[model samples]
Each structure stands twice: as C-alpha cells, then as structure tokens.
Target: MSSYELALDRRAKEIEWENDTCDQYDYRIAAFCGLAAGVIDALFVGAPGQGALGRLTDKGADALVQKIAVMLWKGDKRSSAGGRPRRAPDTLERAISYLEQAFPVNYDARYAADLRDTGGALSSMAAKNHHLLSLAHSPDLIGLIFSILDQFTGGASFLYKGRVIRLIPVKDARGNKTAYMQGTTFSSKLFCGICNWLGHLASDLCGSSSTRREGKTGRGAGLPIPFYNLLLLMNFGNFDGASFAELAVKVFEEGYDLRHGAAMAVPVMVEECSIKLIWALKRRFYAGKDWSECIPSSKHADLRIMLLVGNAALCLVDAADAAIRAAVSGGSPLTFVLHLNLIAWARLITLIFKELRIRYGAGVDGAFAQYLAAAGLNDAYALRQYYERMNRLDATLEQKLTEFVRETEKEYERFINGVNQSLNPACGTPRQRQEASVAFARRHGAAPERIMETPEQLREWLGGADRQKKR
Candidate 1:
C-alpha cells in the first residue's frame, strides 16, 4: 500500500475501529477516542503524580477524565436530538464504574470526598485542586495527546475547508529542530495561541512579561467556540487578531509557515524553571527577608531550596535541548534562530541562579550538599563544581548574549516586514508605491514638473511659487 494508505490502516488498527464510510460523527468520536487513549496510556505509564489505577480512583481523575467523558456524552446526546441515534447515558457511567472496579478502590469514598471538596460544583474544581489540574494539563501530557490525535486524524495537519493547516516544527539558533516529535509541522493561529500562552506562563513566573498589546484571554480567542471549549476541558493549554495576521503574513513571506507553536515549548521549559525559583523566593520573602535584605535568620534555607528546584528545572531543559539537537543535527536557519532565542532564556535563568548564590554565604554549599545527597549523586563535590561552573556568568558570555538578543529582534522585524508585504501587496512595497505614482501621473496627463513625490514636496513647491509671485 502507498504511505498514505498505510497510515490510514495503522490509524484504524490503533483506534481499534474500521469504518470505511464514516460520517462527521464517527470522525468526532475517533478524535475523542484518540485523545482518551492517549490520556489512558499516559496514566498507565505514570501521569504527573499518581500511578495508573490511582489516576482513576482519585478526585483528579474523576474531575479530568469523567468530565471528558461527560463532554463526549453530551455530544452524543446532541447527535441523538438531531435525529441520529445516540449511545446510552450509561456509557460514560459504565466506563467510570469499570475503571473503579478494576482498581478495586472504594468509589463511594472517593466520590463522597470529591463531592464534599468540590461542593458538587465542577465549575470551581480546577481552581481548588491545582496539583491535579496541573498534572492533567501539563505540556508533556498535552503533547502526548497531540501525538495520538495525529494517528487518528491521518496526520498532525488538520483539514479546514480543504486547506491543510499544520504547525511548523520549531528549529533552534544552530538550525536544528526544536522538537522532532512525529507529525510536528507549521503553526496555525490556534497553535500560535497555545505557544503565546506558554510564553505568558514563563514570563509571569520570572517577573518579566511581554505586553499583550492586543487584549486577549489566552483561551481560544479567535477559534470557534466549540473548539475553544474543548481546550478548556483539556485545561492543558493569546493575543490580538491583527498581530497574528501580521505574523502569518510574515511567516509566509519568509518561506516558512511556522507560527506561534514554534515559539511555545521553549517558554514552557523556561517557565518551569522560573516557577521553582519563584517558589523559593516567595517562601523566603514571606519569612521577612527580600532578596535585597539580609538572608533572614533562616540562613540560606530558601536559597538552597531555590538551587535544588532550579537545578531540577535546568536538568529538564538540558534533556529538551538534547532532544532538539538530535532532531536538528545538521541545522537550518529556523533552528539556528530558535536555538539562539532559547539559549538567551536559559542564560537569563542561570544569571538569576548566580545572583541568589552570591547573596547567600558560602555556607549555602551545605544545603546544596544536602540536595545532592537526597538526589543520590555520589560525587557531591564534582556536581557542585559543575553546577557552579555552569551557573557562573562572565563578561564575554554576557556580551554575546546581548548580541544574540539584538539579532533575534532584527529577525522578528524582518518577519514582520514580510507579513506587512504579504498582507498589503500594493501598499506593502516601495517599488509598488513608485509604480503607483507613475501610473497616477500618466492618468493625470502631467507635464515634466507637475508630479511631486509626496504631498509634503508638493506643498513645498507651491509655497515657493507663491513667494516668487509676491516677489
């Protein structure tokens, strides 16, 4: 079979269904199944905090998975109302019951606690249970869901009105793929919004935030309402429409279709680090000592916590970077730009780490050693030395980072120019303006000196002639 045919075959097998002539309903069900299967697999393989069975038994599981089932159930109900047959109401309940029985947990107890804690209102459950919410909506978990969707949907790229929209896979400063997961591609507006949201999360955590300029809640601002609602259900995942339109034009002009999605994963990584750093700082701050003040009577306890968390965050970044490098070994311009941008972010965090360390006395090393001991690193001395070396910021490195920042800014400007040109072809180019001026002069039957380059120039000439007439 051809590759496309093979893909379809594989998808059918994975989804455990084969409908050669499927309607929109079947497609929707397939999408839901792909997502649910991904979530289930992730749970089995160890989702956020809980083990496989624990996920089904906990309030988090009930809140996330059951709600998903409820949504599908609602969709089925609507389909039935529209004259199509619907699945039984008990379908979702049965699934939940089976999961509970499989786990052999006291469902009544879990459900009672869930009701008591949530007050029987699903509306505020997410806010009240942040740990569960974060786990359910983690970037990795969402990314896994995306992977599964790719299989069920025939490709990662989606078809809307016969056009295939895909998120352009990211590349780094060294011309390497930022993420090389299967089916990754260029960005659509929705994908861009996701990236922007991730960026917002990172920026918010680190006390630095880019101006939104365009008023938009990170939720499915421009997308259709139903899809936006789905995103909310996922709880896993931006700006103005005009800015996005410009970005789309620019990306197209640059021979790339990559959009906001390309920009998102890096920020998520950066923000993950910033979150830990912020937690440590806030803990210290509450203890009656600011970074500017003395290291409080608590000594450098907060600093140690910050280091441990920061180190863990950095380790994740390293792993992500390695994966990116592996995907983009030979390098491309896109990857090079992405690499430079990501490196600047990573370095900024490192600088923050150093600043914290300098504020605390050398005795802070004792806390760091404890972290090393807890981590079970045999070479405490070597690990400390390595961390210090990595975290240290020197004059030359700082200068280079500044240069990278400037270059990245220029590249963005260039992309924006492309967007402008693409969006308004006639008014977009200087050459087009010149041609337009010539055409206008021809239409007016202008004499040799009749035409002026601009309104200001014409005004200047008219003023000169009036003065001559007075003379």
Candidate 2:
C-alpha cells in the first residue's frame, strides 16, 4: 500500500475511536463518583466561614503568609553561635508588620474617601472589599502586570462600578509621591518591584496588619480569590439591586476569598481523580486491558464522556444541597449562591463545551485547532515541532500519490497504443500481437505469467511501477 492509503486507514481508525461512546455502566459509575464528590463538598466545603475544609485552607493560607513574611524579614540578624536568623518575627502579627514595613505600595487606599482624596472614582470601594476592587491585588497575570505598573508609576489601578479607575502619584510611607524607584538602576528597580509585589501579597494574604494587631477572630478582608478579581470586570448581570461586579465585591467581603477558593477546589479535584481512578481500575481488572490502555485520559471518547457525566452529577448535587440549606436558613438568594461550589460548576461547564466541540466540530481540523489554542506553544516547542513534521509528511505523501496516479494513467494509455499498433493487420499476425502485449506487461513491472490475467491484475502491476522507479 502507498503512504496515502496508509494515512487514510489510520485516520479512519482514529475517527472510529473518537466516536466510541461509553455504555450505561460507565455513565453510572461516573455519576456515582460525582455524587460522592458532591457529598464531600456539602459536608466539608460549604460556606467559607462555616465549612471545616474552609477553616483548614484558611490555616494553610495563614501558614504560607507567615513563611513568606519570615523569608522577607531582612531585619533579623544572624546569631554568632549559629547561621540561623535570631529573633525572627516570632508570630504571624509580627511577621506581617515586618513585611508591611519592608514592602509598602502607594495604593493601600481602603475607603471611598481615600479614593476621592486620590482623585479616583471608585466610590463603592472600602476596606472590606478593596482587595477585590484592586486589580493588582489579584494573583494572576493581569495582577502581576498591574502590580509592576503601579509600582513603577506610584499609582493604583482598580475596577469599580463597571469602569477602570487609575489613581496616580499616591503618597508612600515617606509621604513622597515619586514615579520611579530612587537610588536604583532600571534592572534593580524592576526586581525590587517584583519582590515588593510578592511581599505585599503575602502581607495581605491573611488580612491587613491592623486587623491582625486588633486580634480579630472573624474572617477579615484578605486577598481576592485567585482570578476572582477578573470577575469584577463582568459588570453585566444585575441580580437584585447590584451588578455582577458589585456581587463579586460582596462575595469577597462575605469570605469568598482565596482561602475559600482553595476549599472549593477540593471537590473538583476529588471528582476528577475519582473518575480517572475508577476508569483505570475497571479497564485493568474487569476488562483485562494492558496498562497502557488503562491510562484514563480525555483523548479517549468514553473517558471524556464519563468525566462530563461525573462533573454534571457533582454540580447537580452541590446545587441541590445549597438550595436546601438556603431554604432552611430563611431563603436568601445570596446565601444559596455562595454555598454552591463555583469550581465544580466551572469544571462541568468546561467539560460540556469540550464535548460539544469534539462531537460537532470539524473532526481532526477542529481537534488540531483546540490543541494549538490550549497548548502553551512557547513551553511545548517539541510538540509543536512534531505537529509540523506530521503536516509536512502528509503533504509529501499526497503529492507523491497524485504524481503516481497521473504517471500510471499515462503509462496505461501508452501501453494500449503500443498493443493496438502491434495488432494492426499490416504489422503482424494475432499471436504476434499477443506476444507484443505480453512484453509490454513485463516492461510495466508485472510477472510474465500475469500478462494473460484480468485487467485488474494488469492495473495492479501498473500501480507498482512508481514504487519500482523509486528503488
């Protein structure tokens, strides 16, 4: 077979594999896994202030904040007896205070009046929800960029009331409003800005320094949920009397911050791991499949569908639990909405869109587009190279196959003309013409015995002429 024929056969098999749907049993197992995850979320990851998992994550965040603070505390001097720093910020409060002094930003404004004084327009901004309003306080790429920009420009950037507001030349601790870092080269200043950004984030991860100092036991204002600051830009929806941006701020104020975000991820991780594990186990033990075949990935149609089913089930259960709790607690819409696991729903929505695209999109072309879109091409350069090579190979095979077909047709035409010329009454007898045709068949790469066979046999011989020419 030619390379083109082999490629077509492989593509057919791939399409068949992709189209393979899961059976009822597989879907049932997926639902069971999802229900189990939902149970875990309901029992352990309810509202941020109430759930056990939320408290655990809060403690973890606090520990992380303290570790970062200690690392950044350059004031502690090394002891003569040992290399360890002596009298390091001994408590979370002390550590936070050290970081506050070490990395001060100009944009620590925590009230509407503060923004007004800075000539900014974020009136709804306050200490309780300032972190959510401030884009630089987020823990994402946008946040990083804004953080660096604010550091360099001595300003703050905030998204509030469906608009982006920038306040420039804000005063720092020294009461001097300067744009660039003093007494440092460009590179040093840039490095310092990054360190300051990270250090400030650490300081605010648990709560403000003053809040810690006051010994507040309540969930004080911390950093916004990872990427949740972006949600403040989604100012379209108006539930009750507030837009989505206001709702996002309200959510952050009500303890749906980064620590609570961590807690929400638990059920999402559980559902995903459970689905993959059970799928692998069933393939290995029940179906007696090879270890390689037992690897559960989204590439498999059945596994993808199973994941979709599982996430759907998890979201369903989580929503139901939230609804029931809300009903019991005087039926507040915000309360029910806050209880719902946003992470699980996000996962389910992603799976649904993926499944739809796979099923209804342009097959291999669509899959390739999706791969390119999702893959970090800068990091996955090897994978990008592999795809380029495959594309080149396919083009070469197609070109060769086309040339072979055209050449075969021309050769067959020439052979028929030669045979007809030999069969002319003026040239030879019947047996002589038949001998001439037999010689033509042998010249075209067929065995002499096949000369007298059917036309199919003769065409098959002609097809091999290209392969023989290559040799």
Best by lDDT: 2
Candidate 2 residues lying further than 4 Å off, grouped into runs, are 1-17, 74-86, 116-120, 179-186, 360-471
Across 1-471, the per-residue lDDT of candidate 1 in tens digits comes to: 999998997675434322113334333433343333223322331211123432233333224434543444455433445433344223323433322222111111111123223323233222212111221122343322333333223222221111223322223112333322222432243254344323222221111112112252221111111111112221110122323222222222221111122222233334334444444454456445445433222234443333334433433443455346435666433332222223223444664565466666666668867775676443434533543563463345557767988999997886565545534555546666555665556554778577776667779999999999999
Give the runs in model 1 whose Cα sits over 4 Å from its true position.
1-63, 75-78, 81-88, 91-301, 304-471
TM-scores for every candidate against the unseen true structure:
0.20, 0.69
State the C-alpha lDDT per candidate: 0.35, 0.76
lDDT of 2 by residue, 1-471 (tens): 899998998687567557767888899999999999999999999988789999999888878878876765554454535333356777878777777766677777777565435554776677888888887888765577678777777778887655567876345644565543533755567578777778788888888777776457876688876667656655666677777677777777888888888899998898889889988898789878778667776778988989988999999999999999889988877788789898888788778777777767757455665674565322233433544675686578668867988999998998777768556776587667766767767777887665664556768888788779999
In angstroms, give how far residue 300 of model 1 lies from its true place: 8.6
